[model samples]
Target chain A: MNFVHTMETFVEGKKKILLILLAVFLIALPYMLNSQYLVTVAVKIGSYTLLALGLNVLTGYTGLVSLGHAGFVAIGAYTSSLCAVKLGMNFFASMILGMVVAGLAGVLLGLPTMRVTGTYLSIITLGFGEIIKMIAMNWSSVTNGTLGVKNIPRPSIFGYDLTIANNGLYYLMLVLVLITTLFCIAVVKSKTGRAFQAIRADELASTMMGINITSYKILSFVISACICALGGALYASLIGYIDPNTFNFDVSTLILSIVILGGMGTIRGMFVGAAILIAFPEVSRFLMEYRFVLYGVILVLMMRFRPQGIMGWKSTMPYRLSKNVKEQVEKMDKNAPLNLLNETKG
Target chain B: MAEKEVLLKVDNITKRFGGIVAVDHVSCTVRKGEVVSIIGPNGAGKTTVFNMLTGVYEVDEGEIIFNGNPIHNKDPKEIVAAGISRTFQNIRLFSDLRVIENVLIGAHIKTKYNFFQSVFRTKKFREEEDKKTAEAIQLLKSIGLDYRRDDYASNLPYGEQRKLEITRAIATGAQLILLDEPAAGMNPQESAELMEFINKLKDQGYTILMIEHDMSVVMNVSDRIYVIDHGKPIAEGLPEEIANNPKVIEAYLGGVQNDAEDQ
Candidate 1:
């Protein structure tokens, strides 16, 4: 235990250097590998990372376990693809539209379900995912029905087409992942984030503390849906085709598995989880269909033993104070009456 | 003392759970800058009264007036926004969060920044966040828990956890604080310290309404005392009066004459 503590501190001290090295490695990954297949795999990992991070906000931070996240993803992909193909909209505009539509759907789901919680809520979300798939299969005019939307043009900025071979999609995914990660961090560190966690901790106490639990819960849903939708928009363009089958119950479970396998409520855990899960099947192709059994066994063992995930351990370092707050605390400490401090200590 | 205004007036408030009357038409008034205690034996509906006052349980009948405003049946968040906050009997701290984070959560209403501002880290967001952080630290310092600000709330000793709960209530910017069983599990020495702490809060000009099982702490710190038995207010007076009241004794010790006759 003592040695582990020392090692944790040692890693903590070199955190900045490690982060920089990791950034360089990620940026140069495609060039170093010199393989289009590896680059596509990396893009897939990035896409899943975004989805997992979105679910983490709701499930991990806000304690709202959702099993219907793929519904939002389907909404985004279909909306974006339909707009681009039918209306000839720009990629960015359609992506934003997709996110907005999915967010509205989230509000629709969040409102009536505000009063329900626990297993009941998860069941509702699971049904919601199925409802969305049914709609996609039946809504022939707009969604193209079971035939699916095809010929999704590659997203391009300034006439530079983004394709897997050219590594444009990979870079785009990287940027989105970075932005999403930062957004999650900002929300987690703010007062809004605190209220979400407070509700997770104790709902009655959170209400007494003047947190509007209903509004916060709804806000959490909107944010999670938006991020997931953004990933779906990218996924449609990357694959150049999307169908209801692409976002079935299995996809939702896959996204949820990444969150659980990496660590719930953690940002970095999403990356590690997505990498391992997305790469595992490819590496174990020789095992064929039996690999899925191994996957199920691994998850069961994970639940039995390290349920918090590989990176879910709470930090041992002191809580980080922002710069201005630290300065103010020091100033207050200097001006505090010595006798008063001593009295409290006694 | 005669001119002291009523900070809270709970009048004829009754709560029913199915066939049971949890709190029956109970009423009490707390004056400004006073430490008022509600004392009762076990299952006397003390916590139910607290829950009703804090809006955790809606009153089946009657009114709760805070500073001349009718507040009963309002949402708990609105009640807190009207400047009332409370500690829980079981000490509900955000155990996974740091101590200061728990306090910051208490200040959630006062944070004032919108979701977009927080996401973008706007000037208003930064200013409000820094101000709240510094204020939370100062509150911890006042209670001598400044050094433990970075520690998870669950890591604190029981006594300190109790103190942190009160501090979190104050961080809500509440003028009237409700403490539910603030000294429930404290030892004699800890209760004595809590007595002093309640007195200190009184000196700081905050109105406190507390339900305490520790008679010593209640009797020592309360400016006035209200006693109830079986969900009804049986007596209310000065602590000395309550101590000497025959009805109060009967309620506590349970009919001495009846016991003698049975013997």
Candidate 2:
């Protein structure tokens, strides 16, 4: 425990430097690899990371497991794709539109399922994912029937088209991932985040704390859906083609697996999880179909042993005290009764 | 002293669960700056009364007036906004969060910032967050749990967890605090300390409504005691009067001679 504590402090102290180095590495990754396939894989990881991070808010922080997150992704991809194709809309504008639509869908889903919890909620989400796919498959005029929205114009900024070969898409993914991470960090650190964790810890206790569990739960769903839709918008553009099959139950399972494998409720875990899970099958093609079997075994073993996931270990460092709070503590120490002062010193 | 202003008036509230009436027409009034206790034997609907008051359960009938407004049947969040907060009998601290975070969550209702402000880290968000954090830390200090503020709430010992729960309730800016069995599983020494701690709160002018099984703490700390049995109010009076009330004794010890005669 002592050794672990020291190690954690060491990591905490050098955190900023480490983060800078990581940022530098991610920026130079495509150049260093010089492989389009590798860049594509990196982009995939980025997309999955965004999805997992979004799902983390609901499942990890708020304790609401959603299996139909892919539905939000589908909504984003289709809405953005359809807008770009039929209306000749700009990529960013359409993407925002897609996100808004998905958020509305989240509100719709959250309201009806507010009274349900645990496995029941998961089932509803699972059905939602299927329903979305069914709509995409059957809704011919808008979705173009399973042939899918093809020839999706690549996203561009300042007249430069983003493609996997040019690494524009990769950088765009990186920026979105960073923004989502920052958003997640901000949400987790604030009063809203505390309420989310409180609800997850104990619904009864959270309600007693005057937290409007209904509104907060709905808010969580909205945030999660928006993030997932962002990822979906990115995916549709990256692949330059999107079909109903692209966002199936399997994709939802993969995103959830990334969350569970990376460590739920930790932002850093999503990056690691997405990197390993997305890159694993590519590198381990030698294992053939057996790679999937290995994947199941690994997840099961993780559950049996480190159920908290790789990065889910609770930090040993003291909870961060804000600058103002630190000053207050100092003032309090000075003004404390003599006996209390003596007790604190001792 | 002049008659104390009533902070809470629970008038003839009834709650029924199917065929069972959990709390039957229970009525009580809590005055400002007083430590009022509801004492009852096990399964006497003490917790049900607490749940109804806190809006965890809607009253089947009657009303709960708080600060001269009928607050019964309102959402728990609105009820808390009206200045009532409570701790659980089972000590429902947010185990995963740090101690200070748990207390900060109690101050959630008091935070004025919106979701956008929190997301954007706006000036208002920062100011309110820093203020609440400092206040929470100060509260922890008062309870001597400041050093453990960074620790996960579940890591605290049982007594400290109970103290933390009360501190969390107090942080909610509540004018009236409800404690559901605050001394359920404490040793004599711990109960004594709790009695002192409750007295300290009363001295701070916070009205307290508690359901306590520990007679010593209840008798010593409460300005008045209300006794119940089988979901029915048996007696209400000063602690000394309650200790002498034949009906209170009968409710607690179960009418010994009457049972003997029946046998």
Candidate 3:
């Protein structure tokens, strides 16, 4: 057990250093690469990572298999775009509003549909994604219908416009991604994280242990929705356009695939999952029309062989590999009234 | 036994399975610091009564008051919070987890640390964790499995699993521990150990309510016995007194006593 702890921390240390190196490389990446096409793909992949990270929280950690993440993303994109286009709110603030709206939607959806488990849950989510897409397509009053919100303004931070091809947006996105990643890692390591796993393991047992299963499960959905929403907000801003097609069911499927393929319930796994899911299609663009086919084949192979996903929670941990460690993954549940009362007042 | 200072009181408890009554109009009391056993033949609703008392099933028509607080029909979490926890007939464990981890989870209700604190293991959290670990390890040692702390619970063979189940219930900080058919799968020697373990818990000030089919185990460990036939308790008294009761013999063997024992 002590060895396990040591290994986890060591791996985390290595990962921290690697992340630093990756950030540095990204900062210098556009300069080194002559192809503007490659730089553009890199940015898209970066944005997709956030979506995958968010979806991973729902699918992997909390074990609430959602296929409606794209719906949340669409909600985010429209909310932020509408805020910028009509409400005249600043870009970052609009994105925050977008996330809040998405989170609230998650809570509402989670309340009614949380009873859906396993395959039933998947079907419901699938239907939900379609419904959301239909609404986005038909709702002209708020969304401008299928014509979509075009001429979306660039996000200007401190009156500095985030112009395309390596600008302040790159650093902003990277910094936010890093922060969100850290937040995710923290959440997964906490007590609620354990309760989420315990519910996944056995809802009956978890409930018997005094864990408020419903709260934690809904919390997972809200967090996941917020993250996906943030991704959408950024995506629309970066592209400076929006359409019902921009938030398609394919994006949701892609996000789900990244979480599953990366390793369900792993914070670090999201990075790996997101990278593969986002980059795979763009990387295989040379195959032109067959790119999606190649992507499907890759996904099929991954599911068949490594169903646990690339960076599964255990594998991605800064620790030694143990057999079926998920079975022993701890249970952290309940509220601390003492801590709450002790907290300093504003 | 109004004057008996009841520690637990069940008033008109009934449990029905669709159309059949499993526990019918059953009400009983467990006095403080007493060792009580619910003994009956197979499917006599003894375990059902235990389940109801432990808050596993909602009572059809009764109130369960523990330490004078009404606890019937509450969620199992609330029941546990009210200081009642149990061991299953067949051990239900997070089998793949380490022995220490299993107990740690059982002790989850008492850990005051927040989620963030547990992850970062803030000094306060670490202190609390160390205290919990020490307490859990102490319990493991008490049950003679401290050395197996790191081993997977499922790897401990049959008897140890039973022991682990008891230790887990104990770890819950429960004042009242319900043991359902705890000695069902154990050999004579293991049963003897469990008998001693029961006494040890009693000595530590836990009130035990156990269900047992093994007559010798019940006779040896229980200070009192409640013998149920069908869904109703036909007799409740000291084990020796219940053993000699005419109704108990008929319930166990149907009318005539066997061989020379009858005379």
Q: Which prediction has the highest TM-score against the true structure?
A: 2
Restricted to chain B, the TM-score per model reads 0.96, 0.95, 0.93
**Lowest-lDDT window of 10 residues in candidate 2 chain B?**
B254-263
Measured with C-alpha atoms, the lDDT of residue B177 in candidate 2 is: 91
Better of 1 and 2 by TM-score: 2
Work out the TM-score per prediction: 0.95, 0.96, 0.83
Share of reference contacts found in each model: 0.62, 0.67, 0.22
The C-alpha stretches of model 1 lying farther than 4 A from their native spots are A1-8, A333-346, B257-263
lDDT of 1 by residue, B1-263 (tens): 47699999999999999999989989999999899999999999999999888888989999999999999999888899888999999999998888999988988887778989989999998888887787778778876789898888989999989988988898888889999999988888878888888887787788999998888888899989999988999999999998878788888888785553342
* lDDT accuracy of residue B136 in candidate 2: 74
Ranked by DockQ, top first: 1, 2, 3
Q: List model 1 lDDT by residue over A1-346, tens digit each.
A: 4664686799889999988999999899999989998898889889999999999999989998999999999999999999999999989999999999999998988885568988898998999899999999999988999999999998989888899888899999999999999999999999989988998898888989999888999999999999999999999998889989999999999999999999988887898999989999888889999999998898899888989987777777777778998887776763343123113221
Provide the global lDDT of candidate 1 against the true structure.
0.88
What is the C-alpha lDDT profile of model 2 across B153-176, one tens digit per residue? 999998899999998998888889
Q: In model 3 chain B, where is the ten-residue run with the lowest total lDDT?
A: B254-263
Off by over 4 Å in 3: A1-35, A113-116, A313-346, B1-5, B54-56, B95-104, B113-165, B183-196, B214-220, B241-256, B259-263
Q: Using alpha carbons, what is the TM-score of model 2? A: 0.96
lDDT of 3 by residue, B198-253 (tens): 88777666788999988888988898998888998799899989989888888888
Candidate of highest lDDT: 2
RMSD, each candidate, Å?
A: 3.4, 3.7, 6.4
